[model samples]
Target: MNEALVRATIPQDLVKVLGVEPRTDSQAEAFTRSFLKNGIQPNSRTDLNSMLSHKAVVLGYARPKKDKSKTKSKRAKGLNARQKRAMKIFHIKPEHQRYELFLPLHELWRQYIIDLCNGLKPSCSPQFVQQKLLKADFHGAILTVIRSKCPSHVGTTGILVQEFKHIFKIITKEDRLKVIPKRNSVFAVEVNGFVSHIYGSRFEQRASERSAKKFKTRGTIDL
Candidate 1:
């Protein structure tokens, strides 16, 4: 679309919402002509305002309107040499600092986790690490960590269960002879307790399951 039309037609509310001051008649119209003549174009909402992978947000994308740079044997235009110098002197250059940064995913995740942990009420506790594993299909490992530490799974499960329960009793005051759930069959590896890293990280779900097996072996190995 013609940038002039955009400048003329775009809603005032949109400019205000984007925090960009609405262009006055002279500047907007002049810039629009310069842009069209120079083969540079205006970007719409999506392309113009974007968050880079590194979390930096660019407010505008002012790329060349044409790909004339790749054309060879292209003759120069009728603009005089002194005019060219003046144009260069009066050109508006895009600067790096002009961009605005939106929220980055990683930072969002970190804040979310911290907020959840802090906001754990008695009625509904937030278990990020545990839930994250389970959601990622690491259910096998979650059980392993819980069960391996259970005395209810001794022979059918492992001596580790009883031993872990012992430590649980000593550490958690409520753990004194509580009726712990029996260990699930075919699930023995606790992730947090394991020292070896899991493979196939590309398979996030399966990898999470295997990786989570560590929490079991990495459990308190009694001295």
Candidate 2:
């Protein structure tokens, strides 16, 4: 808890492990007290040594003590700050929510989407946009963003899903050929290929097609 208490309690030999050879017990105690005053915890001698060694590694005073055996080497490898940051993949910042779920798009939101499309995230993956969408809990993400940024807007699952699809170019050009006429022109909409009338068209169209095929099968068997 207290630096004075920690120094008084930790062994003089372990304090020397910090690379400061003590001329006396008091010197060793002072040396140990100088660093890790705030972090020091009351623990057993072995645990105290391990904690100090870890602190030394973090401050660049020492590399983690290595072992010759292969198994021990793997176990000793601890992730530093840089490694932890590297582990975090691409994520959209909250500012990107300036793009409303509906029309009248903002330039900032549009530019952010463009950045994602162009592989502007950390790595060179062309599919980062698709990955971002797939990894997200679609409905939950929409609700979260809307609640946090656009609290006044009453957005639905269909509206958010369509907006996401238009932004990410999830719909194929061939699929658009038949339905484009049922909706506004691509350029007319803030998000290209987004037609208010055709928002839920894909789902309804697929369901109808499946129902028609099932009906035809029944008709054939009856005959």
Candidate 3:
């Protein structure tokens, strides 16, 4: 074959073998010059074969890098302003606030207390019972306001409905939903004939918050 034909054919084969198609003539010429610089002559059949026998070196453009700072990660935002406003606006109707309506809830609460106190056996320590009561879920409990700073709040009995950060919403036997402030009030509950008193003054926390909190026993509280 002619030397010019051999040179042209070698570069074409190099393009195929290397899997790189040079976009411009300058790039193609540069690739050909680099190949020729490797000292492999393409004029003779043996030299051409030797040149083709060598391992092919590929060329490619690098992939574009991604920017991590531009990427947005989702985060949880609990109870938005709209939801908080809606909660305050919507409340249980007076007609729906009946004592019989929450009897099932009270029963469930009684069973929950029983299981929590491990059947409230006589062998159970007073300290253990007290601890359990402090962390107890009182939504279904029969609560009676035995003592309160407000005279009108005293002797109020109801089934607890919603427990907030500083208040207990209870549905009374008169089909009335009463919002009792936890501050300066004392409530009583009976579990399996064992009566327990709760000092509402110190119990001013959400039920969820109370569950994970540790309380220190006080000798005497003037309430």
| Winning candidate number (TM-score) | 3
- TM-scores vs. true structure, each candidate: 0.15, 0.16, 0.67
**Candidate 2 accuracy as lDDT:** 0.34
What is the C-alpha lDDT profile of model 3 across 58-173, one tens digit per residue? 54678899988777676756887589878875478767788999999999999999999999999997777877888989999999999899989999999999998889999898
Off by over 4 Å in 3: 1-71, 74-76, 87-90, 217-223
Residue pairs in clash, model 2 = none
Worst lDDT window (10 residues) for model 3? 43-52
Question: What order do you get sorting by lDDT, best first?
Answer: 3, 1, 2
Best by lDDT: 3
Clashing pairs in 3: none
**Candidate 2: segments with Cα more than 4 A from true spot:** 1-29, 43-47, 50-213, 219-223
Scored by CA lDDT, what does every candidate get? 0.35, 0.34, 0.83
TM-score of 1: 0.15
lDDT by residue for model 1 (1-223), tens: 9978865755777877777876677997677555544543445343321222234434489876776767666786687759877888433243411112111322453354335345433443223334433223321121222223445534231112112211211111122222223222223333323221112222223333434554433232211
Lowest-lDDT window of 10 residues in candidate 1?
Answer: 165-174
